[model samples]
Target chain A: MTTTTATHRGFWYRHPNLRLAGLLSAPMAWLVVVYLGSLAALFITAFWQVDDFTGQIVRTFTLENFQLVFTTPAYLTTVARTLGIALLVTLLCLVIALPLSFFMARVASRRWQPLLIAMVLTPLWASYLVKVYAWRAMLQPESGVLAWLIGPLGLESPGYGFIGIVITLTYLWLPYMILPVYAGFTRLPGSMLDASSDLGAKGWRTFRSVIVPMIFPSVVAGSIFTFSLSLGDYITAQIVGGKLQMLGNVVQQTYVSNLPFAAAVSTIPVVIVLLYLAAVRRSGALENL
Target chain B: MSISRPTKLILTFLALLAFAFIYIPLIVILINSFSTNKSLTWPPSGFTTEWWGRAVDSEGVRDALLTSVIVASAATAVALILGILVSLVIARYRFFGRESISLLIVLPISLPGIVTGIALNNVFTSYLGGLTFLTLVVAHATFCIVVVYNNALARLRRLGGNVEEASADLGAGGWTTFRLVTFPLMKSAIIAGGLLAFGLSFDEIIVTTFTAGPGITTLPIWIYQNLFRPNQAPIVNVVAAALILVSIIPIYVAQRFSSDTNKGGGIL
Candidate 1:
């Protein structure tokens, strides 16, 4: 009986395509049908308009939503602000992550690497809302932590606005930047640095030419997280943004009353991310991610 | 790699500053959780555990906690099965559109969360009846699949096919080889992935906000709702402090089981 069962199973296993199909079908169905299908539905909805009087989504294809998103000054400014914030956050994360990751990967002793990495990663596990809330507490203009710490220096907290949002976002996404860049640093060949120094290249020259070029993909990988996350974040803005708005804030606000317009606003980020991904694909950053 | 003394000192200082930056807010949450002040004023006026006790006894907290746990567990389970299946195919078989499959797996996560949230929200409300617990699960599992898939794929690739070939060379059938060999080897990876998926699901807020039906409040949603309520603010701090404290365990465990020196576990 065992031999017969083994023969039957072996026969099925001999056909790799059958085995592949068996393995691939369920996950593919979920991904293509549910995930991709939803995204397509969303983009399709962008070309739709909501009837003003009836407040129903008109199924007819129209460029009105896209036009409103592009043409309205308020909407256009929101898009530009969101893009600026994402870029600033990504740049801040890079600046902060480069040194921190360098310290962890190169300056720190090997025995301490895992512990240091763990320390950086611990904050990531903290609830996102909680972290943003914490930032709220920290940024409370007059009596907040920032004011308490920096008041003696004649500097005040930026006080829950554009600067505050950027700071909080940079802090939030810094770990995402650090880990990949740290990995890149670890993968960097020590010999290359040694050769560069031996060839009389100064520290800045070696860093700019050799280190930057090699770790560029990892930096881009980290930037993807910072950029997209900042672009899509409404909660942070809501909690600490005061009167400031981003693309996500608009989407969240309009999603209920004007989903078509919301969908159109959302496409801006989607298009930006896709274009960013396509541009960075040449750097092989997607694989790094 | 070759650094001057000044550069090394500067890097070290910057790294410590970064660490401080990362941790100060969490520490603030911890401190404020015990503060007698309701507004969370700096220096905290005085320390007390009354909020902790209140949080422990809060019915809303309990219900939200239970809901989050259930949703996370279900999502993790679904993600585990899908992750294993997809990773097995990608790792073991050379097929057409293999690269595309990997990209497809990543798409749900790589895009901004708001896009994903609204997209799924549109579908759930329009075509799928309405948002429900099941909708939350599906939405979460979609993104959670990538975490598990990456871990499983890494482990499967490292495992190679030689062991399975050896098992087949013996009298073992395909199912037997998988049950007795492949599954066992992949167990740690699956656990690490599941832990990660659970974490992702548990902490998810943006997508959860869209997909969760009325009356279904996950922990993060609970925190968000309560964060602004003056009377509940201190309790919110207590919960946030508790989350930061409790999160260390799974992260540490995942790091240990992740086994890859280069990747530093599921965090990536």
Candidate 2:
């Protein structure tokens, strides 16, 4: 089991460095007690039965929670809506981030490229809550900036409820797309692009064929990040989607109000995420990186 | 084909428009914070810093802000430590469950925040005891750890094993080698990761909402409650604007550090 370090343990065996061990101890302990333990407890609580009407959980074990979650139309719809919105957001991020990332990588001067990346990265550093708050103010029905600008046109409310949430998520999480895309673009061999141009390939053609294939992994990485994040997020939907419930919201409500059922609903997204990850792993996409 | 000047200008304008789209609401709130009117009417009826004074004077806002600071600081520190350990182990050692461990550490980050929150809530409220400040810290740390670990592990990989070997060869123990060689190498990454963790924990609402019991409101929670206050709601604007103000300095610092690291072209 020790492999390379098995023989070396004798060196550290005599007097264990308390300072180094002390330094490492807290985080290791935290990982065990807080992270792994919490996950275990969460799993166990998910099996507990819940009382109807009052929305309290009982200690008794039952599959009723799972049954309720599977049978409920609202729960299914929320899951569908969550997945749909995440897909839309991922698509939107790709559409916007691709061209911009390409520009940063292929066109911009080396001196200017870092500055531009920093600019794109700024929104990511901003508080998530603040970004959501900003979006809320910008999308208010009457006095919103969009309403002010586009009121005269057919777009009376430019900020559609669920649509606004998707847009805001795209705006906030676009960096995830742009960063990987830019990295992929930067890693593109300068020789290949030159070869394409030398062969009389046009700019768009070169991008569509040569560039896209090379960066497909980055695209996958970015898409996975944005889609999963958007899918799992309940706040943006809760804050901006008005009264509409997404999977996140439903899971949240279940956690706070109905414990067992919420756990069951939560399992759907967890299984889906695990399945996706496994699929990605089986394809060796992550290993390729 | 060579790009024309007008096309360049148009592209620049479009980029600028994108920036504006993201920044306008933030700017509006900043501007509206000084409005004389109670309602958050766009462009403001007139200008006065009355709401700012009110926000500053309010006990609830102050307490919530303080609580947020305490929780964020505690959580970020915890996550930073955890991140260093996990990153070091993964980077330096070959363990049986290494790949799975890596996945587990990153899962909370890549998965939806709602899932993390709900999972944590179920654990804390059920098996664990009351939701105190420590609970919030633990919840925040769960996700925050990924950022630190990612940064640290990437740096560790880039540094390679030679330095540690050399230190040991020169009659240093493992701890000493780590201290003099590895720790110094990873300083900037740790700092960057810590700042990021702090920022994330500070503004995190989803997990905080689930883990925090009633009567212990964080700044985000408070802002959410006050968001639609029927009358005198501009105070919420003022608070939000103030939060933006508080965050800008650290956010800028974080961006600066992360970009510098990116440009340095070593690890990640």
Candidate 3:
């Protein structure tokens, strides 16, 4: 039998906001405990010195970890290489995604639009490791399809190291980049583009003035994904790059090697990404994206 | 000279070419799953079902797939429950620190997976204890909860308070109203949210890698180790193809549902 809900029965109900606040408390606690607190804990560990034998950290804090991160050639090069890869990946995503997304937004038939969108997002659901492994197989020296296909073009060993890894990363992250761009383009006022053409502006000029401003936020969002994914990828570089250590690999190694110094190196990118997000939010790009 | 039909034709071809660029590699992987190559040879020398058989029989692969399923499902269910509760509170009431709370939830996802892995690993080892599948589920659910929360919260905000007021005025009880009105309306969003969460959790490797420790190896870990093995190439392809199949279903369903609602001037 249905019972009428007692209105304002409990002390907590005296203030509805307090009751609502209580309901929100669980998720907030999780955010604090897991997201914010873990980072704080990791940051503190970066300052602690590691014991030689036991592989335990000493309570005594020092700036030596930070110093080692700066001085070490391996750590520094890995950081540089990771940044380079991130930049390249972002550029590649932008180049390919911009036109494709624009076409999807502007040209596709209404019935086909959802299908196209689904096609773009399908890859995001695939098992990440399996996707990477698929690439590794596809990039194999003698047998990979690339080796066979590009043979006529005179490029020997099509899928060996850096190029192979870069190609794979581009393929995997392309969807992420395209989604935001598509969203941006879809939200644009179509009448403005019509007016631009009506005013006798050429296609390219109209695109520059009308399209770019609207889609800029999408580029930022897509760039964030491509850059951060590339920056944080150790497995892709390790597996596909054939044991090549990127910044992500360095972090893994440092954690595995029990090197407090290397651990400190990993902390740098976290700060960089967080700061980047903060800046984007401040710039009002978050809402646009 | 100003505008040519040939140029328009070329642009259309180029657009189709872009789709080919996106789809061809994946199609190759799918096609190769049925190839008879001992290694990953191109344009297969022959055809066979042997790899699919091998994929089924391999203990390591079998165990890994099982582990992956368990982890993904558990993470999804937990995150969905939490997402509904949190979204309800956020949508219905104004609270202090709401923006900051939302940011905290969203921030973990913005940072790359590796950083999250390291941070979670640091916490588990230093503050908690020996890592297990449970811990991996927890780590995965953290980010996944945010996604589900976003989807459900957006839906909840649109629903508003009229339904509850109507139910109460009609003499329906709190539990009855929630079950009949609020819960039924939330069903589709929750399904969408759950599907999204499942895809994410199933594919999640970075977070799982950190928390899995020594004992647990999921399908990703299994595939990772055997990626370059010449003998296992066919089996790997079969497994990879299977993974692709598994991942695409949920995304396709969700996208179709979401798009349908949008066309209907937003879902209730």
| Candidate with best lDDT | 1
Model 3 misplaced regions, further than 4 Å = A1-13, B1-10, B168-177, B256-268
Interface RMSD of each: 1.6, 3.5, 3.8
Candidate with the greatest DockQ versus the true structure: 1
Candidate 2: residue A239 Cα off by (Å): 2.0
CA lDDT, candidate 3, residue A271: 74
- Model 2 agreement with the true structure over B154-175: per-residue lDDT tens digits: 7888889998988878767676
Predicted structure 2, TM vs. truth: 0.89
Writing each residue's lDDT as its tens digit, candidate 3 over A258-280 gives: 64655587787877777777777
Pick the winner on lDDT between candidates 1 and 2. 1
Model 1's alpha-carbon lDDT is 0.90
Instruction: State in Å the error of residue B196, model 2.
Output: 1.0
**CA lDDT, candidate 1, residue B107:** 89
lDDT of 2 by residue, A1-289 (tens): 3544644644464534543455456765776677777666667777887677766668887888777766888777777888888889999989887767766776667999868876766667667877787777677788776677677786765464788888888977887787777888898888888888889887678878888888887777777777777877777876778887778777776566676777777777777777777776644345422
State candidate 1's TM-score: 0.98
User: Which digits, one per residue and each the tens of the lDDT, describe model 1 over residues A22-105?
Assistant: 889999999999999999999999999899999999899999998888889998898899999999999999988999999999
After superposing candidate 2, which stretches have Cα over 4 Å from the reference?
Answer: A1-10, A13-29, A53-62, A282-289, B1-14, B255-260, B263-268
